[model samples]
Target: MTETTPAQLIARSNRLGADPKNTNYAGGNTSAKGTEIDPVTGTPVELLWVKGSGGDLGTLQESGLAVLRLDRMRALVDVYPGLEREDEMVAAFDYCLHGKGGAAPSIDTAMHGLVDAAHVDHLHPDSGIAIATAVDGEALTSRIFGDKVVWVPWRRPGFQLGLDIAQIKAANPQAVGCILGGHGITAWGETSEESEANSLWIIDTAQAYIDEHGVDEPFGAVRPGYEPLPVDARLERAAALAPTIRGIASTDSPMVGHFTDSEEVLEFLASEKAPALAALGTSCPDHFLRTKVKPLILDLPATASVEEQIARLHELHAEYRADYQAYYEAHATAESPAIRGADPLIVLIPGVGMFSYGANKQTARVAGEFYVNAINVMRGAEALSSYQPISDAEKFRIEYWALEEAKLQRMPKPKSHQGRIAFVTGAASGIGKAIATRLAAEGACVIVADLDLEKAAAAAAELGGPDVAVGVAANVADAAAVQQALNDAVLSFGGVDLVVNNAGLSLSKPLLETTEQDWDLQHDVMAKGSFLVSKAAAKVLIEQRLGGDIVYISSKNSVFAGPNNIAYSATKADQAHQVRLLAVELGEHGIRVNGINPDGVVRGSGIFASGWGANRAATYGVKEEDLGQFYANRTILKREVVPENVADAVYVLTGPELSRTTGLHIPVDSGVAAAFLR
Candidate 1:
């Protein structure tokens, strides 16, 4: 066989990882053993290049591979101190690294290094795990593959497990792989292509076996009352319950949530066997690490009203937390890491579907995907025999493993507004766009709400696509539109914690020239609009019980008594007062209401470009293009106030720096002395 290179290994890994049916996101490891010239010794040396910790194989790169000298790696066996000291071996891997060591070695490094194969693949394919976790897995393996695949008993992943697998491989030369008891599967070959083919063969063969002999209903009959709700009703209920679920899940720390109602999830949730099997928990270490020991299955039936379900959710959440605390106390030893969190990462509702929470959107989404994989494992295992998994004590050991805690510790500090969701009206352009960009950069997911759907979507794309930002058309003057925008926010990002009321237009006209139509138009867009948006958002904030921020973009004219601006000025003044009123009223709920007062923001502003600048310039007797400089000259600081200046104030008001400062109006008018707050 031709020797495999690192590049070929990467290609092979990508192919295997691309299909969800083969393995889950970041759930497996692949390795290639090759020879390299030693820089100092000027001689050939063997090296093991394996996928590193926290990397997804589908997107693996050269930088993601940890290169270790095989000679040094194998030397650890001489000093092996038995099962009790297996964890210390992970730390010792640093000494075996080749050169700068591309990426951090993972717990599975020993498995790759100890096994005598030129190429190796360890994966958690749903089909492979089914046979591995079945009650009669050993007999099933013997009957299905004969001597082609071996079976190894359950063992926690460490150096000792590596030794066991190595011994099994040596004893059975005909075997291409082994079904890791209560875990996953491991396959290897003399070349990358062979190894990949072997892995696929094992997965396919096991799946075929299950297909031929499996029972008709693996998860048992669907409970009559637990059948999936109608499509519209399911979504409506999911939206209503998301904020409350996200709230309880984030009791310890803020989290972004993802909801799914796929066929697999709905089928399992509606099954009579779901509750008992869910309590048994996931078998794969990768599965439980992201999903927690088990999900919080909503006890109420699908036929229950949404209101009743919500009420029962609160009680279930309390009980879940208590049960989690007990689980921690039952298994914690003096050497174990502190309890990470009591909140269940995955929450399952019989008909409403599942909601998963994490520190960010991708993590939350991937956790849900992993739980689906778990559901598949459960389905297949039950079909083959009974779905047996690792014991609670073993699960506790891996969950609180010191090595896992160290990985958590090494993670970089989170950005300022991490896990926050912001809804910005008029975000398609000008100050609103600037605010959205800034907030997203600080780790807040943004909902760009504007009257122009195309522009809002374009700006959302520029900010970072659906993950970080999404666009919704909203005429804030219309209360229904405002409500719909908030609903979109809830659906897109679970809920809104920050709202920027910045949608408005101005008409530079005197008292006689300012018709009644002008007054109504300006007031409706700014004064009434801010109130409508705030009112709609408050319901979600109160429901979440997570506390929130509402910031109004007023103007210097709000207090400075600018000339020929009666309607615009009146609306601005009304908006400024709304900040104070809402701040006082929402204070008990920990919702801070604030405002930013800025002078002419002429550059790149949609309002200014839409003829408002020319009108203001004509009113002030200055060239239209010079209106920005004209306004700047009048400020005490002589600085041109741009949209970014207003955006900066919004960030500060909603950020932790001003967490306690509510009902505050920050003047971003380049130091307009007359507009200064008293």
Candidate 2:
């Protein structure tokens, strides 16, 4: 099987499911039914606005979309399962279409129903197809993925496919992600953006594999997951897991595989399952857990028994689990240390080789990478001999040991930013980027700190000046690096200005199963990181005798009445108050502090789309067209601000614009005062 993309996603209301006469699935837009106020933003989820029916996502637009409510679609599916009253479903859809005239629901909505992620994207990239269909795909996948990724035997895709992924994650908590044999890959995250990156990586990996083989064939195949099945029954069942992730590929092509290669260093690259992942990654990092940090190739003899293989693998896992227990027992001294619920450190499933654990998804990914590197040596040991990443026992114990969990707890506290030159983490993109860019454009020399130094440099470069921007890579949460970034900024830019504490991340997860470490990440960046960057900035600002501004990028979430927003909102509230206190204390020397509240800024480098988790995106109506006006409509000014807009606002505070005002906040949203303000 090869990778694929849907030529068109026709709304059932549109009556344009197929065009036998024309290959393109073309249809008209039909209005959706039902509209309601989004609790978070109060913006109406316009139930009607189907853009178009049939068009490849690569070429999709608002015109290609058909709008329909998740509720209404559920109604239709309710009537149509058992292939019962499909016509009735169609008739009902038609009535809604004629009444609304915007867009119809996609036929594949049921598939999306199965996912727990937010945004879903399915495409048949050429490279992905090649690897999926290759005869020795298992070997090739092993060669490419190593221990970084998990390989699932080829299975027909659909509701079962989504179930497989969900099950895999649960069964193998140590696995980074799973690979679909003979089918394109899938990735998920706490946010829509991270999922998108994971999706892209699937294709990236395929392309890398093809390139390695140096072959190009007419890559085409039947679309795997899109057959019209009895979807209505499934929809009802899937909806139980509120906010389904959905994606449809109209055609199957080889260019759809994920990942390029493990070009990233293990320790440096974060884990796939790590928290705030939606903020950290562009796409899936080189998949390591199931795939190995890299791949392994073995021309096995027919004499090898399945039992023999199972033993070799389970034995390794036993070693891992045992070591993990030992480590936890040793480190469990903290009257039950905070990270008691942490995940396993390492896992080795026989033929699956081995994988390492990480503090966060990012760090776990780093662990996978170590094993991937080790795999290369395994192959070189001899034909029958293979290398494992530090035996199962060693990895398990290391990964699970309480000392490991303690390390995360004992991470260097954030720098006390009292004017010592505040550094904003995540400045490569989003709110942080906006603040940094704003500072540089406004004449204050700004250093863009990001984990990806290249992205940092590019962001600065976009300012179109050398002196205005200095790209410095550092994890703001890391004390030493935070200090180092500050030192570099001081040496190069002279001194720090009002540190615009404007970098933040959010993960929309139901608290029930959300990992323990993820919650820490939210505080680490929003609360802890804020304290560190501001503390450093305070030192420099206080010494200068010049009052400074520290603007934080908080969210409407802080004031929300909801369930999943706990980690983010709580941290935002804490951060906002912290700024207030910092202002009161630092005001003695002219140092000022403030925070900026903005709704989602979807435009201008939408990394969220890059890492989109198909499930959540659809729930919040994070469609492209809706994004432009989504926040705009919610704000008071009826203007949707972007990263640049927020950046400019922060720059103003640091520049001549707001020299007098401190201990205040500017709402970047046009009219969204009620959410965070009132």
Candidate 3:
């Protein structure tokens, strides 16, 4: 057990899991055995340290590795030979832990214990998966690394897989590794360094073998450098389908989809063989567990209208769900529980790249990444011969395995907004962006709605990845546009939990100087825009039957007016009243309506981008640089108001602090006397 301490083992696991090409998030596992004194008996006993269920190897910690008595775990093999149920085996493993319910030892711990080495590494590296899932996996394993590794046929991971692994090790005493067909590879050594190096060496050697002896005839039809049709090029078309797909996939727990149309993704989708290959199955079992066996494919034309696309998507989804039910029926056993859900985790559109779904943006992005990698693995395997993934029965067995189900149950509880979705208008900058950022940080998927699509997308990208936020163009003043945007929010993130109606503009002029154009513009955005966006989002919340929060970014001018600001003040006043009416109407539906009136945020606000601050500073007879100080001095608290100050007020109203209170306006103007709530 030299150099195989828990700390060293964790470090080795992290090194191997760090590279996605090596192993994806929480995809691989490693284990080591060392001797420790039993506290009660005062005797040395072999202790097996394995990665805990649902722990990511890349960020492995001492706590993530569960310590089990090797002798007790190994004894289970003798006690439960030819076990009748997965539950019995899982329970046996749990009993082997030093602490009764400390952390569930990895399902692979049984097999790891039987390995003749002190350390064992099980990885789902793409390079080895390509060979392991190939049609002639046994032949490929024998040909590539002759006598260095043994090849085990496809076996659902459980007590049976562990037994098979032990028998293989007993027979091939000199073999350093075993490649599980249609799964991944495993390596063993007396030292952690050797196990890590041997595992990677096996993968690199297989990849080199593939490179050296090119396939005589590739199986799939893939072309190099096809015409680039980015998803962004058809942003409107893609956005149209987001809400539809999201709604169909939504179960009791909401899920969000991450959209991607990078060049590589586009090239893969554009390939003639993509549809056929994608339908085949996942390249590895780990992936089958994350994403279902295959994605739901749809035919979407770039020019299709939102209505047409929605109708078509609904038709396709019906068929997809039916097929999924058929798949479950075909493979279910008496021991198997009811199928979790028939919803597809991945969706493929002909003209679009790809979209992956999960409970939140982070999980969605992981699905997207796994699917993209699966594409590459499928191509690599096809080139070698045929892309031969595990059979449907095997996939079903692993997907519904009791041990796997327990892993999910044992995971920690989620954050308050873990599966919630939010839409923030004018989120490209200022207070809107801050609110979106805060929601995402709290584990909510966000939609960045703005008039500028490109800028909105850029802001979404900055906030997180495509998974964390989606950007859509919407003129909130236009009822149709507002409705479509709300529909898209539902489609992309399942449903809306919080809506920040923060998109508005200002016009500073005397009542006489404020002409028809200025007056109309202010009222259209501040008054009409708030009404349209709130009503549309309210429809979603009502349909979901889940309570939601709606906050309007009203202005301090609603309570206190400034000279030459009649148009802006009047519109804000309208917004404040609209909140009250909506609150009264939507209260029975469990939707809380609130407002935050902010002032003196001259720096980052979009309303002041057109030299408004300079003009205001001139009126005060001070330099533009001194405007912040002037505003600060005017406030009773003498504090400068920032966009974040406004954003904090929004959180207070939506957060548990005021969960029971609604129809209220919180002022964020650094204690402006006239604007204080009276």
Task: Using TM-score, give the best candidate's number.
Answer: 1
Task: Name the weakest run of 10 consecutive residues (lDDT summed) in model 3.
Answer: 219-228
lDDT of each: 0.92, 0.46, 0.80
lDDT digits (tens) for residues 1-678 of candidate 3: 533488889899999989887788888789989987778899787888989877899998888888888888888877774756644776788778875534567677777876667889888887788888889989989988888899999876677777788788778878889899988888988888888989989988877877777564343344443334454455655655565566666743567677766665665666667767878879587787778889887665444556776777778878888998999999998878778888888887656557788877778878888887787677668777678898888788778887777767766788667777889999999889888888777777789999998988998888786667889898998999998787677556656888998998876777788899999998898788988998888767775556789999998889996877888899999999988998999999889999999888876887777667776787688998888889999998898988888777776787766889889998888889888777
Question: Could you give candidate 2's per-residue lDDT for residues 1-678 as a string of tens digits?
Answer: 001111122222222223211111221122222345655677665343333333433334555555454455445444554332232343355543423444444433333433333334333233443344345555655777665556665543333444456566656554444455533454444333444455556656655554555522121121222121233422222221100000000011000011112322121122221112111111111222222212211112112344443344334434434543564565544445442322233332211122333322233333444334222212121112211122333333333334334545656543222112235667888777776655544434567778788998898788653445668877767777776676655543334555666555566676785577868987887798888888876765554434556777776665654455567778888887887798899888777787777666777543344532222355466765576675577566888777877776666665555667877867666665567565
How far residue 444's Cα lies from its native spot in candidate 3, in Å, is 1.8
Query: Between candidates 1 and 2, which one is better according to lDDT?
Result: 1
Q: Which wins on TM-score, candidate 1 or candidate 3?
A: 1
For model 2, give the RMSD to the true fold: 27.3
Best-first order by TM-score: 1, 3, 2
Per-prediction TM-score: 0.98, 0.37, 0.76
Q: Give candidate 3's error at residue 598 in angstroms.
A: 8.0
The TM-score of predicted model 2 comes to 0.37
Q: List the candidate 1 regions with Cα displacement exceeding 4 Å.
A: 1-4
Full-model lDDT, candidate 1? 0.92
Best by lDDT: 1
